[model samples]
Target: MNPLIQGLATIILGVGGCIGYFYASNLLLDKVLYPAKGPNIASNIRRANIIRPWLFIFPALLVLTVYLAYPVVGSAYRSLFNRSGDEFIALGNYVALLESPEFRRSFLNNALWAIFVPVMSVTAGLIAAQLSDTLKWGNIAKSLIFMPMAISFVGASLIWKFVYAVDSDIGLINAVLAGLFGAGPIDVIQIPFWNNFFLMFILVWIQTGFAMVILSAALRGIPEETIEAAILDGANPFQIFFRIKMPQIFSTIVVVWTTITVASLKIFDIVYAMTGGNFGTEILPSYMMSFMFRDDGRATSVALVIMIIVLPVMISNIRQAQKELR
Candidate 1:
């Protein structure tokens, strides 16, 4: 029962079982149910071809139903109930949730975060992409900037927590401010309303790198002819960017925007690690986590709210993907 052995066993069994099932099922269908050697071979082959795709997809569909669909449906169902889930109090949790000042604050903060994070991240990313494209050491510069994307949210939060620490000697920001401007040690994350922005800065910092990497690739993918054509028209750098490059990469920008938007909606780790959802920095995900064990119904309600917010972005992404696929 060693952990590593257990893991290896699980992996072997899972993969081996999947391979065995598919092989056995296909063999049974082709050889046993409708043999290709017998009469009506052409029709049997056509039938098998039609059914084979479903057979291949069946396992994946089942996995999605269990892992993705069930949780969402179950959470929606749970959101209508009371604390212990014995009493069916339809919409009561939502009503109480909406009426509460804390939840409202969290909702407002989330809205602000959703707005700021995506826009700023995308803007910063675009700027980085453009600037890096002109430099000889651009890849090195980009590697440094995009490095934060590899850092975990919790790790980034911890790093920023030290930077924003209240102790002037310990916190770099406080130390710099106090040394230069003689400013007092500022508890940045303790201030209400504005504290939300402070917390959001961490996410923006982390997400900017992700945004940069994606936007950079999109920028690189832009044709050289378009820029040359713009140059021929006496277009300035700003004009070239806004008029030509921006239009070309608009869909990519939307993809980055919606991606960060979804991440912001589901943001939890940074806020949880840094502020613990304190000082009015409670976002939907963190707020939901706060009530997770204490109030199942209410927690599920918050989760549903987060899901509702993300639904549009998810749909938009899906449509964009499908359009691209077509």
Candidate 2:
């Protein structure tokens, strides 16, 4: 059979099956319960009628169990073993990770990311959003600021790679520094500790737009009446921003902080593209990938570490979303 024809047949069958199931289930329910409605009903019959829909839900639940829940459990189990997939090493992978210097540096880098990226990005975004809000050309400013977010992390890394290029003429940073300070071209990625900061700046550049858009929306949601009242009370511009606007959007601040924090935790592309996790720039995800050919134990440990690091922030975000929904 032709692939397109097969695909169309499969889709039609799926639609037909779903329609048949609904039609049959409704018919069964009507015959068994709906036609027998009475002034008084037994509790068991009422319960059974209520639970009839659950029969239809069972297939979806099973699918989720297989696809989502099982894989998580299976991955956790696989992490307990070594690369051979035979020996049960228990927490040996984790123990090795804790003692490894490379893993330690990766952990430290991730911690820096969780702290620095969110703070810097959110701060830059907040400042940009505030400034843009007041400007007549605010839309143009926002478009330019947001342009970076449209670029892939790898693409952004390549763009910055030229900016930090080693040759004075080839790299923008080197050219500017050479002209202004009479200094030689610098290989920014090769610099220790600080190179991580440089790599993180790319992420900050990309994520700042996301932070700004969310924050700008929140800023717009602020009531005109509140600002007027603050003005009537003789509040200065700084006072209105700090005392009134900031407080109203405090929850949004938390949301943006955690959102960036989560992205930072899983960051891989910029570091991988610019440095290949070299020069002490490895974070958890890239470090985990390094073990793909060699030590499965260490790699799994890194994966678990990433999971553990992200779990708390994920939970907090969930709770915040729930609160917002309420």
Q: lDDT tens string, model 1, 1-326?
A: 99999999999999999999999999999998777877899999989888999989999999999999999999999999999999999999999998999999889989999999998999998898889989999999889988988899999999998999999988998999999999888899888688778788888998888898999999889999999999999999999999999899998888889889888888799989988878778888989999988999999999999889888877877887799899
Q: For each candidate, what TM-score against the reference?
A: 0.95, 0.83
Q: Which candidate is the best by lDDT?
A: 1
Worst 10-residue lDDT window for candidate 2 reads 35-44
Q: Candidate 1: misplaced stretches above 4 Å?
A: 321-326
- The sequence of per-residue lDDT tens digits that candidate 2 reaches over residues 93-169 is 88888888988998998999999999999999999999999999998999999999899999999999989999987
**lDDT score of residue 151 within candidate 2:** 97
- Clash count, one per candidate: 0, 0
Model 1 TM-score relative to the real fold: 0.95
Provide the overall lDDT of each model, using Cα atoms, as 2-decimal numbers.
Answer: 0.91, 0.87
Candidate 2 segments exceeding 4 Å error? 1-68, 321-326
